[model samples]
Target: MKLKLTLVLTIVSLSLFAQTKYSNEFMNIGVDAAALGMSNAVSSTTSDVNAGYWNPSGLINVEDNQLALMHSSYFANIANYDYAAFAMPIDDRSTIGISLIRFAVDDILDTTQLIDDQGNVNYDRISLFSTADYGFTFSYARKLPVQGLNYGINAKVIRRVIGDFANSWGFGFDAGIQFQTENNWKFGIMARDITTTFNSWSYDEESFARIQNAIEGQNQELPESSEITIPKLQIGVSKSYLFHYDYSFKTALDLNVRFEQNNDIISTSFASINPALGFEFGYVDMIFLRTGVGNFQNELQIDNSESLSFQPSFGVGFKYKGIHVDYAFTDIGDQSVALYSNVFSLKLDFSAFR
Candidate 1:
C-alpha cells in the first residue's frame, strides 16, 4: 500500500508538470542577489538568502539569520515589482528560508462597455484594471559531508490576480544539487517547476455571467472556462573562478538553457540560451560589474515572424559592513521595444548570519 501511494503521487506530479504553460511575466521578475550575480547562472551552488528563489541548495551556506529585500520599477513605469526573503540555519546540517515575490500592473484603462437590452450602448466608463502575480516559497537545504555536496528543495504557493478575474491558488517545487570541489571549482544542477499546475485560476462568475447575457442575442456559445499554464521547465549549470590579485578580483560565468512545450497551443516547442559573465574588484567585495546576453528563436519573437534576437544586460553591485545592494538593466531589442524596452531592478541584503 505504501508503494502504491508513492506511485500515485509520482504520477500525479508528472501529470501536473505536463499541463502547466509558460508565462514570460514570471521570467521578467528578477531576484535581487541574482541580478547582481549576472542573473544567477551560478546560483544553483551559491550560498545566499536569495537562494530561496534561485537555488535552494545554496541555502546550506547560511550560518546565521538573514533578511533580503528587492524592488524593480520595470519598463520605466508600466509596473512595479518587489521581492523579500528571510533565512536562518536550523542546525549545522540544515537551513530554512521564506520568500515572497510580487508584481503589480497599475492604472490599466478598463475599456469595457455597458449596453442596454435593446442593443443600444447605455454607457462607457473608464475604470482601472490591475494584475499581480505572487508566490510564497519555503526552502530547506542540507550538506553532505562525504560527497562535499549540498542539496535543497523549495515548495511554493503561487497566486495570480487580474482585476476582478483572479486565480488564487497552485503549488510547485524546485530541487537542486551542488558539488564543491578543490581549487574553487564548483558544479551545480537544478530542475525547476516540477509539480502540478496552480489551477486555482477562474473567471469571476459575475463577469462571466455578464458576458453571457450580452451575447445571448447573438446566439454565440459561451466560451469554455480554462486555466493558464505557468512556464514549467528549466535546467542549467554554472561555474566561477577567483583571480590571483591583491584586490580579490573574481570572474564568474554561467550558461543556462530553458525549454518549453505547447506554447499557447500554437507553437510546439521553444528554447532559450542565456550566458553571463561578471567581475568583482575590491578588498571587501564592495564593487562589481556584470554583463550577459540571451537569445530566442524566431518562433518566440514578439510578432512570430521576426527573427529571434539577443537581449543585452548590464548590472552593478556594492557591499558595506553587513548590507549589500545590487542593480541590473536589460535591453529587450528593437522588435520588443514598445512592450519591454528596458527592464531594471534593485535589491538589498541584510543578514544576522556572520
Candidate 2:
C-alpha cells in the first residue's frame, strides 16, 4: 500500500508543466502558529521573527534580537516539517532576518529493484529512501523616511532532494512594504518571486532507469530541466481596537492575487483573487485567541453543480515577558480534502534576559 502511494506521489510530481501554477508551494505553509491561526493575516501586523516569511517589512517592528522555532506533521504523520528563524534590529531604522524551513517524507520503500533482471523475485532488494524540500531565506527591512512606512527584501534559496535519485536548486527574490496610519489602521503588500524564480533539476541516470516503467507509457525519458515560478502578490489591511484597558480586538483581511485564472472566488483574465479574513481577541497582551477563514474554492459536484468551500483555522497564544508560545489547529488544504494538524511554535526575545 505504501509503495503504491509513493509511486502515485512521484508520478504526479514529475508530470507537472515546466511553468507550473503552484511553484515552491512549501513556502506557503506559513511559519508561525499565530499567523496560521489567522490564515496569514499578519502580513500587515507581524512584529517578530516569523515576519521574515509573512512579510519581511514587518520585521522592522522587532524591538530586539528574537528567535523562533516551529514543528508539525502532515499526511497522517507521513511527512515532518520544521522551521526556524532569527531577527535582529540592525539599527534604529533597519532590521535583518534569516529563516530556514524543511519538509520531508522519510523512509519510503523503494521497490523498483524488487524483481531481478533474470526474472528472479528477490525479497531483499527493497530499500528505503526519502524525499525532502528545503528553503533558506535572508531578509532585510528598512524604515523609510516617510512616516509609518517600511520596506523589505528577501533573497531565497531552495533545495529539493529525492533520495539521491533527483535534486534541484532554485533561487528567488521577494519584496514587501508596510504602512501604518496615525489612527492605527495598517496596510501591507508582499510580492513573491518578483523576478520569476527557476529551478534547475538533475537526475541520476542509473537510478532514473530503474523506475522508468512506473507507469504504462510515462517516464519514457528524463523530465525538463527547468521549472519556472511566476510572481504572486498579497495585499493586507488590519486594525486593532482596545476595550477599556486590558481586553483587545483585532481584525485583518488579505487578498491573495495569482497571475492566472483558477477556481478562486474571484477570477479575471489577468488575475484571480482569494480573500482571507481573521480575528483575534487579546488580554493584557499576554493571552490571545484567534480564528480565520480562507482558501475559497469552487468545487464541482457530481451533478455538475458548483459549491463554494473554505478552510477555517483556530489558535491560542501565551506570552510572558518576551517568551511566547502558540498553538494552531490548521489544514494545509481545505478541511474536506486534507486532515487538520496541530502546530506549535516558540519565540524568545534575547533582550528579555538583559
Candidate 3:
C-alpha cells in the first residue's frame, strides 16, 4: 500500500512544473507588500512589524507598537494570500510579535472515477471543494548585551487542508541575529526551520476504503501518515545612505541556502541557493519607492534550454501621521504561463495615535 501511494505521488510530482523539494512552500512566500515589493531582500533592512516574517531580529528597530495587515492576489488570481501581524515592545530592550499568513484556493472540482462491476467506466462524479494553507507565528526579540546586536526566535504552527479529503499539521522554529554598525550598516543571518520542520499527513481512511472497494481487485490501503521536512538558511546585509537631510536610500542583498537529503545522499546546488537584491528610496520618511529582483531557479529549470527564471518587484508607499499604505507589483515570470501578483498593505502605529 505504501509503495502504491509513493508511486502515485512520484508520478504526479513529475507531471507538475514546479520542482520544489519541500512542502508548504507558501510559507516562504514573502508576506507584507513592502517586503514582497522589495523582492524579499529585507532580511537586513526591515524595521516594521513585517520584520516578524523577514528577520525577527529586525524587530529591535520598532519603536512603537504596530499592527500590519496585507492582502494579495497571487498566480494571476488563481489563489489569494493574506497576512496580519502585531508587534509590541516589552521594554527598550525586548520586543514580542505574532503573525498569521494564509493562502487559499476556492471552488476546486473534486472528481471520482466510477467503474461498473464489469470494469467499465460508469461515469465521472464531480463535486466542489477548497484547499487552504495557514501558518501562525509567534516571535520574540531582545537586544543583546553587546550593544549593537540583537537576537530573535520564532515558533510557528502550520496547517494544510484539502476540503474533507486530507489534512496536515506541522511545527517549526526559526532563529535569527542582527547586527547594526555605528556607521549604519546592518547585517542579518536567519536559520529557517532550524529544527527541520515536519508535516504529518492523514488521509480519509473511510474514503480510501470506499474507493478501493469500488475498483475490482484493488485492495491497497492508504498509508497512515507521511512526513516531509522544510529547512533553509539565509544571510543578508544592507546599508542606508543619507543624500540629504530629508532624503535617504537603502539597499539590501540576501543569500539563501538549503540542505536536502535524498535516499541518504545530501546535496547543495548553486541553482538551489537563491540570491535577492532590493533598493528603497525615501523622501522625508513619507514617500517611498522600491524595486527588487531575485528567486533564481535556472539550475532547477527542467528545460535547460529555457532562459533563467527570476521575478522582479516594484512598489510605492505613503506614510501620514501614524498610518502607512503600500502597494507592490510582482512579476511571476513566464514559466510555462504568464503570471503576476499584486499586494497592498496597511500599517497602524498605536503610539502615534496615542
Candidate 4:
C-alpha cells in the first residue's frame, strides 16, 4: 500500500516509480529514434537539434537552423509520447536550443461513478480523463577558448498533471562538456539535475474525493512528504571511420552513473553504473543503420535465482537534402522486461530551404 498521492502508477510501470530512485523518469525515455536505437549512448557523438536533450554541449555541432519531431506509443498503444526540438547557431562558436517532451495516458476510466449513492452499480456511469507529464528545456552551448572543446548548460521546467485531481511543477539545471582530439576521437560528460530538482505539488482533494471513498485506507504516503530528484552523470567516448570514401561507421559507448546501490549491472554500496554501446553504419552518408544493446539488469526470480537481462535496439535512417527520417524498434526502461516500442522521427535543416 504505497502512497497513491498520484495516479502515476500507469506510466510509472516503465521505471518502477520511486521518489529517490528515478523521480523524473519520463525524461529518461530517450527522444530521437536515432539515439534511442543506440540505447541512449550518444553523449559524445550527438550533433544536432536532438542534442538539446542528449547533451546540450553537443548542440555546438549544429550547422544550421533545425527542427525535429518524434512520436511513440507504449504498452500496446495505451500511452503516447512525443518530442519536438529546435536549434540554431548564434555565431561561429555558439548555439542555442529548445525542446519539449510530453508523455501521457488518455481516456482513462473514471470509476468514481460506477456505484451510485444507492450502492447500486450503474452500467453507463463511467467517464474518461488523462494524466500527463511535460518537460521544457532551454539550452545554450559555446565553444571554450580551449581548442576542440565546447560546453553547454540547460534550464528545465517540469509539469505533471493527473486529470483534474492533482498537478505539480519543478525546476532543475544540467551542464555538460565535449572534447575532440586532433585524431577525431571524441569524449563527453554530462551532469543532470546538478542542483537537485524539487517539485511543488498541489492536490485537489475535492476532485480526488471521487476515488478516495472507493479505496479508502488503501493508499499509503511517504513519511517525509516531499519529492526531489537526485543527480546523474553520463560519460562517453566515440569515434568514426570511413572506408573506400563511400562507407562509414561510428562506434560509441556511454557509462551512466547514479548515486545509489541499485539493480544496475555494476553496482556498489555508493553508486551504480549502466553501460550502453551504440554503432552506426552509413552508405555514402545518406542511408544509415544503427544498433545497440543496454539497460542491463539483474532480476530475482520466484525460484530465488538471479537472471541477467538486456534490451537490444535497432534503427534505420534516410537523409535527402537535409531532411532526415529515422525509425527505431526498441525497449524503453527495464520495461524491456517484455514491452517494446516503435518510434519515428523527422528532422529538417532550414538552411536547405534557404
lDDT of each: 0.59, 0.89, 0.78, 0.86
> How well does each candidate superpose onto the true structure, as a TM-score?
0.75, 0.96, 0.84, 0.93
Model 1 ranges with Cα > 4 A deviation: 1-20, 23-28, 33-37, 113-125, 211-239, 248-255, 258-283, 296-308, 332-354
lDDT digits (tens) for residues 276-311 of candidate 2: 999999999999999999999998899999999898
lDDT of 4 at 11: 30
- The sequence of per-residue lDDT tens digits that candidate 1 reaches over residues 248-337 is 544555555455442221234575445545444445466776665553334455665555444556677777756666666655442356
lDDT of 4 by residue, 1-354 (tens): 222323335334312223555677898888999998888899999889998898999999999999999999998898999999999999999999999999998887666667899899785986677889999999999999999999999999999887776777989999999999998999999999999988776666676566556565633331222468999999999999999999999999999999998888999999899999999999998999999998888888899999888889999999999899999999865643668889999999998899
Per TM-score, the best of the predicted structures is 2
Q: Which stretches of model 3 miss by more than 4 angstroms?
A: 1-20, 113-126, 209-224, 260-271, 299-306, 333-337
TM-score of 4: 0.93
Clashes (candidate 3): 0
| Strongest candidate by lDDT | 2
Ranking by TM-score: 2, 4, 3, 1
Better of 1 and 4 by lDDT: 4
